[model samples]
Target: MDDFRLFTSIRYDPELLKVPSLGFTNVGWNSKSSPFHMLDFHRDRMLRAAIYWDWTAAIASISGQEGLENLERFLQGATKDLVNGPHRLMITLARDGSLGYEISSLPATHLNNLYPEYLPNQSFDSDSNISVTVRGGKVPIKDPMYDIFVDSQRTTKSEFTHYKTTFRDMYNDARNRAKVNPGDKKEVLLLNEDGYIMEGSISTPYFWRNGKWVTPPVPRKFDAFQGSGGNDGTTRRWALERHLAAEETVLADSLVDGEECWISNGLRGFICGKVKLH
Candidate 1:
């Protein structure tokens, strides 16, 4: 596996930083949600970002150097390092939809085990917190589809959602659980809420047949049910054009038959290494 070299930054759980000795909270999320859902709460216009799903990154360098710091300082240092081109930030959200102050180090897998945990989170408490050994290995983004993917979405979202929204309590619990079960296991397959074959630990769901990048219909779990803005959309507005494949089809009814199933997401952007699912 190759390390996806992108500009990187770090954020932290301010609470953890206040107590500097304990390990820091390392996380991130795809925070984008409709603000109108809380129209009543915003009469004063006091607002914060609300995301659908939030996850963790990692905490380490390949050389065993712990780079734990408050996010403001981390971002400043990352900018100073000058390697920060396209960056990923590690963060934690509090229960109230606020951010924590412990940004993680590089090599995201250390945060939540990119492979398994990111898809299906785990559960842990003060009793659990296994000592993480095995210093490091940074796997560069394997799919060239990512850098292009994250940026390709120039389409306007119907509503406003600030996912990767503020760090919250649910987010904190999930992050802690990931420690007990690091998702780096290569063989693990990511499933949806129903346990159906959905996607990989990071990749989105897509299948190739006749040389096309066709993905499953965006599931209803994340759909916006009210007026206007909803989850009915694409990771990339021009998903078909960017992948250089043609003929878009939706598997919302069912998975694409016999085509090549590849997972597409921020981490493992696109993966075609599928063996068999049924």
Candidate 2:
């Protein structure tokens, strides 16, 4: 089968300046079943996510003085070509005032790597096949660090936590480390400066404690703890709105205290696993 394909506005055009824009929407096959809840919140979510990329020029150009209208027009056109599938669609605005978008699909095998059984509104549940490891080494500037004060106060001056920029070297490192020494893992959970469980490098980490599903609290600049960091993902929102999950502070060593563990992202939705700290 095809390794999935991409339909991006930048593919054909070579002179685009590549200005950063925030917005991505992914849907499962059949176009109607969006397992990650994209159907209900993708548009709004994209707008909210755009806050992370709110550059001065981008904001000034699109803010007051009829600029917002033009920006909306660009957003509508950029996201218009998206359709349902096991795919990811992203729209980015160029610094040179160009719109770029990409729609990418994944094959069944790639899908199986994250979820053994492909189904909408379903999570990966495997025996020993799925494993997780806490991130080690120094935290990068782009990645979030835990702040106990941030958790208590609920401040919102978060910079990198809410955007999906391409700064993923730290996450990539954790994933690579998990693959070492026999290799029985697929996800890398992270911890904050104070050594508390924060989130997955690329996904939201959750645990099954007592009789309820709980996830790490969202991090703010001076709130208290390091959050799952990223926009409010559709899966996380779905779990919360449906009462499938709750938010609470979690410690790194406390990971073993849970009866079950899981990580979620737009692409994987939710992938259940067992923790193996490193």
Candidate 3:
């Protein structure tokens, strides 16, 4: 299956998850170049994971500016035919540094509309120079508000959990233990043995505490039994850089029922979510 390949799901969109601090101009539909969200961060993350796993070939494949450009070109060519999209780009890397990808159309989520503060100025020319035939299909429906739950089981933190790769058995197991249905608009949060919240099955988890947003802290290094951390997600990194959220140890038992909070990932930005403790 595709899960055997090391991968990352990137949101290739004309608009979505765009912030002014990223220092990009003519983003979204106005982009004359490839419109990949947080491309640098994603590249760096994969490199770091490859280094950790000692995947030398993978490291060399995505090492620097040249690598970034190569990746951008690949994405552009892959989506050149799409007339309109906010598609999810599933990029996979093999041990030999060979690349594989799959593109799927995505519906507009409430991300940009609900979090306008994170959006870039949209006063650019309306006549976008990008020319691609729009695929014929019914307009995709907006994603529903997600139902977030805390898993009863504790997960052991390791390199797999720290990196965004295809080895997602830990996450998949957590979801299964919680009996999460495939079509359910739900995310199950994982906790470590120390009782600190790690992250969600497929997204980073955040909480509102003391009037501030706090996510679980991820340690730089951890021994087999010592490090109980979460993935350093792209959205999580962006939030930390902008001070939109802070890193603090969040105990799993501290979460309250029906509390409002947020969750984020590369494909989906900060999503308005509600806690459902069981």
- Model 2, 13: alpha-carbon shift in Å? 26
lDDT of 3 at 61: 88
Give TM-scores for every candidate, taking all chains together and pairing residue i with residue i.
Answer: 0.34, 0.54, 0.79
lDDT of 2: 0.42
Ten contiguous residues with the weakest lDDT in model 1: 35-44
Candidate 3 similarity to native, TM-score? 0.79
**lDDT tens per residue, model 3, 12-70:** 87654343443333233222333577777777777777777778898888888888777
> What lDDT score is found at residue 247 in candidate 3?
83
Model 3 lDDT on a 0 to 1 scale: 0.69
> Which stretches of candidate 2 lie above 4 Å from their native place?
1-40, 56-85, 93-99, 107-158, 180-185, 219-231, 257-259
Please write out the lDDT profile of model 2 over residues 155-269, one tens digit for every residue.
Answer: 1223344444444445455555555222233556655555555566556766766556687676323233346443355556655654657887676656552234656655545
**Residue 134 Cα positional deviation in candidate 2, in Å, after optimal superposition:** 33
Runs in model 1 lying further than 4 Å from the true structure: 1-74, 77-88, 93-98, 101-198, 219-260
lDDT of 3 at 150: 87
